[model samples]
Target: MPCCPFCSSDMVYPLLNTLRCKRCKNIWKEGEENPGRPAACGSEGTSLRIRKKTDPLETRMKRKLDEYLTRSKGKFCFSAMPWQAGDISQELFMRYLKRCVKDRSLAEEKDRYGRTWYLRP
Candidate 1:
């Protein structure tokens, strides 16, 4: 799947002949050579600022999780997890955590208080 050039989100869908990014709601023509730059608008030929492509959400999440784990000595609960504000939700984070555990990249355990903690394997 092609990631959105604006938000680096994979949640994009085709709308007519163009593709629309669900995360940032930006629309661009499919197969465009430079998706990072918006098409020119009006007679003046003004266009939105071009954005540099960024890592996909999954990769970014992994990096943030790794940073937090390192800072916390390799163990952390969901409530204490660090992620960019408004970038993700608890449910999404849990889903990613599940994938990580399944991939054996991370380990999870329940403490006496029934709180789940995640750590690097």
Candidate 2:
């Protein structure tokens, strides 16, 4: 557990080119002593990489949809409630959601009331 360089709080992460302390809100860079050191990152690729590709809208929606399914832990109906749509339209939403079902990236379950859930496959 690498602590924040400024506050010594155990929350530094991803070996940022300019790391920001979650607690102190200070920015820093890895020092010479930390080069090639192991970081507690879950990423399979090198954690010290300076640039990370941001997830595209579709990818982010898929990820968030998966997260929603896990949080609900059973059936999640998109129409039953209003969650963050995040620049996605109802038509496009249905398109991708159905695509996920067809491709088995997600599973579908219809409840008694006719509401549906998109579960992870």
Candidate 3:
């Protein structure tokens, strides 16, 4: 039930041969005086390492598309093509939208003037 030196959280647990802090996610060995700081490079024992989570490309595209549709009243003319997500190229953006339509996440409708509109299903 030792406290985390880095975050001062009491949510510390033994992981294999080391202690892990739930709050800061830092790992250190048991009975170590300074578990808050990482060991010097090339020294024995574990050093601090942090991993960041990132969404996949398709997931990111879907999120961006959802945001765009919401802003555009849940529908927009396909030909006008006003939405551009981040640094993605026009071709990639259209490809993602077309995939969504194919998967039935988005519906494609044609007006009397033969203009195509993409809308949420």
Leading candidate by TM-score: 1
What tens-digit string does per-residue lDDT give for candidate 3 at 1-121?
A: 5565454567888889777866545566654455555654334664543222266446666777787687779887856666553534456667778888898988989999998888988
Best model per lDDT: 1
Where's the lowest-lDDT run of ten residues in candidate 2? 43-52
Question: Per-candidate RMSD vs. true structure?
Answer: 7.4, 12.7, 13.9
Per-residue lDDT tens digits for candidate 2, residues 50-71, read 2223655567667767667777
Model 3: CA > 4 A from native: 1-54
| Reference-based lDDT, each prediction | 0.68, 0.60, 0.66
Q: Count the backbone clashes (under 3 Å) in each candidate.
A: 0, 0, 0
By lDDT, the candidates rank as 1, 3, 2
